[model samples]
Target: MGKYDLLAKDIIKKVGGKDNILSLVHCVTRLRFQLKDESLADDEALKQTEGIITVMRSSGQYQVVIGNHVPQVFADVCRIANISSEKEGGQKKMSFREKSLDLISGIMMPAIGILCACGMLKGLNSILSYLGLYSNEDGIYILLNAIGDSIFYFFPVVIGYNTAKKIEMNPFLGLIIGAALCYPTINGVDVPLFGHVINATYTSTLLPVILIVAIAKPLEKFFNRVIPDMVKTFITPMLVLLISVPLGYVVIGPLANMLSNGISQAVLSVYKISPIAAGFLVGGFWQVMIVFGVHIVLVVLCITNIISGTPDPILAFTTFVTFTTTGMVLAMWLKTKDKSLKQIALPAWISGFFGVTEPAIYGILLPRMKHFVISCLCGAVAGAATAALGLKYHTMAGMGLFEIPALLDPAQPGVSLVRAVIAAGISLVIGFVVSFITFKDEEPSQTKGEEIVSEKCKKEVIASPLSGKVKPLSQINDSAFSNETLGKGIAVTPSEGKVTAPFNGTVMMLFPTKHAIGFMSDQGCEVIIHIGMDTVRLDGKYFEAHVKEGDKVKKGDLLITFDIDAIEKEGYSLDTPVIVTNTNDYMDIIAMMESGSTVHCGDDLITIL
Candidate 1:
């Protein structure tokens, strides 16, 4: 068993066993579940469970809030629960916007790290060549450049494997799908399609592969459903390959070409109307175009412009976007309280300086969307500045930050290079300041949990479940409780061995061990009144539950009574936690009394806002 296997099994059981989970996917932190019934989930048990941060129910998803390591836990959950598309009745349905973003994220995220590394190398190589340390003709330079160039040139094949995994199709077929699209030049074939010619090359293009997979997913699903089991393995592959390949060439291939041409012409038309306006639009919407796989048309246009001896204004305008993303990532790094997000932000922004913003875009900016908007706004301003100042790319240059040298004449650098520098600087600053100030995280991104205050909500109080010395969660012995990973609220050292309903609520769970009780208020607050640390190991010794799961209880009603002295003598600390497991639902969870204050049963222990 893996390290997470035990946690995974326990989670599955607490979530009402394997049968309760309809499907599972993870995003950043939470293990998102489509449960057969949310009520069946032991929400308190999960909150009290080690490693889970908290639980959240939002938009029909029963989200088990694991912190940064959710992906690992998600894997283990899927494996142990025997969850898959077929078992879960297929993956959860998503809206068009959700599907599109998820698809882009899945395909691009896997390659981002390597792309960053290669881009940095390529940037360094450009620096070397510009400085006359090594020329492109050098054998060593050739090999290094080849390594750096391979992923971008053959990105479609890389995308193919990832897309298949995302859509639950065979990865090798995805590979073949990518390879077949790229290897055969459609322009060379002259294939006819409704009086339109399939006269385009798919090399280094993302459109054809993405379109092919989008089409192949349904076709493959259809074939799997209809094909006989006897010859399914051999026959399905044959049919999918035969059908998808031709469709990629005749139909999807033509569609990509048409889209590319239409986009390029539209951009050109805008550019002709006013270069400054075009620059602003490109700066703002270029990333959006990149998301849809149409930005390559502008890339092609830039190269064509350079070949024909006009400075590529399009490329110059687009350059500001890199710095904008980089600056926003820096803001994300500085502003986020999440250790994992901070860690992600560091490497991503560093890569941006070298001219690879893929990591930053996919990792930090795209997920939050506010960061993306800030970056785009910055980019639009810089793009407009570039055009307004007549700063265009003097020649075809290397990728990323290293291209700074290419825009300048080594012997006589002019105002053009200075203007370019100024534009980029303005974009970066705007991106950083705006993103840092405006963005809010999924959690409270600033301040440690110390004060128990907020006025955004009306006052609602949780009476002391046990009368004792009130303590902050930080003073608790258990890391899960101390860290507030299980959710927020204060702890209590019980002088009396009794737990009562803190509010009028149902007993959501009475752990079979009889040590911990989970309650949900009629007002919708979920609380866990854990009796003692590691007391569950005592096998219900010195513990008695007056209430069973699903019983409705009034405030001050006795729930569970434990022999606190016996549990303490047995080496378990009776630092019981009365946690608001759904702490995020409120503005603040306030501790009513200071730590070390003596409290009686039914005192206002917690003030929820």
Candidate 2:
């Protein structure tokens, strides 16, 4: 905490002191702040401040994207600002897709491992029971049942804890409501309330628990406010349990569950009516929804199907969407001439093959508009074709090519392997053709006609840490870079060397993993050169170093030379990001024209105010 004092003060000063911040909250990797006056804050300067990686303003909240150490910074921010660590509970204005993904990630991340483990256990139990190796009456079966079934049977408990955290409520009380839902006497009691008899059991049922928690949350807050502090510790929990839980079980649970079930059934009915329409809706919107974290509702529906032998259509469609992204990557590989581009596309193929398309979508295709649109359209068409032909997915597993076997349900004679293959092949060919038709041709290292012409004398700007070729910052991921907050910087791919010092500067901080380095220029600007995403796995094997922490280096000195061959061999690209770590301190950042080998050391590759 003491060591964090410097970082805390630095943030306060950079953000215009403690007074400027109105509210703050943190999710695992970022500190999301609401400010009183965004104009009074220098976002670029804040990004350059020590310990801050990037500043993003979106969704009405100023998001400080700190990689992994955000929790510490968040704690420090809370201490300095003298505010409760809890965020104010209010409605957030996120698109449906955004909310869905957030809810899904929140629910799934903490419990996915458990889901997998329990699913495996359940599968084993089924095998043993079928083979007569063990009886359901056996002690092993009972123990395993308790172990595996605890998660799904007591799902409310897990959902309660996670949802409470997401909405910034007391987790303890959330679990209490969850436990109450499972309370034997209460869950079994049936009363004819309003029109329908409340005969639904809480165990292994979704409607009751989720609805109760949703309703109970607000009720918990109301009780806390009205009750006296001295008596609240005991009286509040008692009151909420007495009023909220029963009220939820009798009214909210039954009603909400019926509504949700109706919605789920409606979705299924629609899919059954026209598989093609279902496929298009799920495929086109799957990744889009997933990106925002709202895909959880769909995930829960799928899990429900898994537990009850029912099936969900949305999950069935995601498999096709994943394959489509894979097809797009292969298309890029077939179309691109840049050696580095091929290197990136290779791993993207592997990741996509296994159903993790974030690296591929965000890394490879989304950067290019033609490719992105082409792949998505092809995916939509392919998904529709597959669904129209009555293709079905068998199990809930990773959504990729490998899952093809798991997806095949022999009983559903309407689905088959051949149809999947046909669908996959059609997707790939269409994606490839579309990409080939629209792909841009390879250009020279520097386009003379497009280069920005400057009247100032040409200072000898050195080559960026990345070397194969360079692209304008505007062409790279995230337009925020071009906003000049990162100061003037260029994107480059090092062909045959490692990053080195463009000019003399102090080594501000060398990341523990050695994949990145930050330096402060004599003029007080900060610069960062990061080799690649997840390149830390290289483990310094190919990094030939010339400097250590706190050591000063001159212009033209080698800071690090990487074995491009080794890196490429290990299935990684060498696209390095050389950024001005502290661009906010300056008024203006200017990029010089791209040039040839005539450039010298200590030249102005970029200019700062």
Give the alpha carbon lDDT tens digit for every residue of 69-123 in model 1. Answer: 6668877888888875223444444556645554555565455446545655654
Which 10-residue window in model 2 sums to the lowest lDDT? 452-461
Identify the runs in model 2 with alpha carbons over 4 angstroms from their true place. Answer: 1-149, 184-197, 226-228, 290-297, 300-309, 385-396, 399-440, 448-450, 453-609
RMSD of each: 13.5, 16.7
Runs in model 1 deviating more than 4 A are 1-90, 184-198, 226-230, 264-383, 386-420, 424-579, 582-609
What lDDT does each candidate get? 0.72, 0.63
Q: After superposition, how far is residue 230 of candidate 1 from its true place, in Å?
A: 4.8
Query: Candidate 2 residues 1-609, lDDT tens each?
Result: 655677876676555456556557665345666654343345767655756656655545566655345667777777876766644434334457545544555444556546655654654555466557877889998897688667777777777666666655677777787777777766667767667677656655555655566666787788889998889887876776788776887777778667767767876888878788879877777766544434556777777655444555567666667677777787778778888889878877666766666556655666676667667777787678777756654444434665454345534322456676777777667666766677764676555533422211223233354445665656544333433334457766666665668667687767545667777655455677766544655556777667777878776677877778778888876665567655444455566647232233334466654
**Top TM-score model:** 2
Find the candidate with the highest lDDT and give its number: 1
- The positional error of residue 593 in candidate 2, measured at the CA in angstroms, is 30
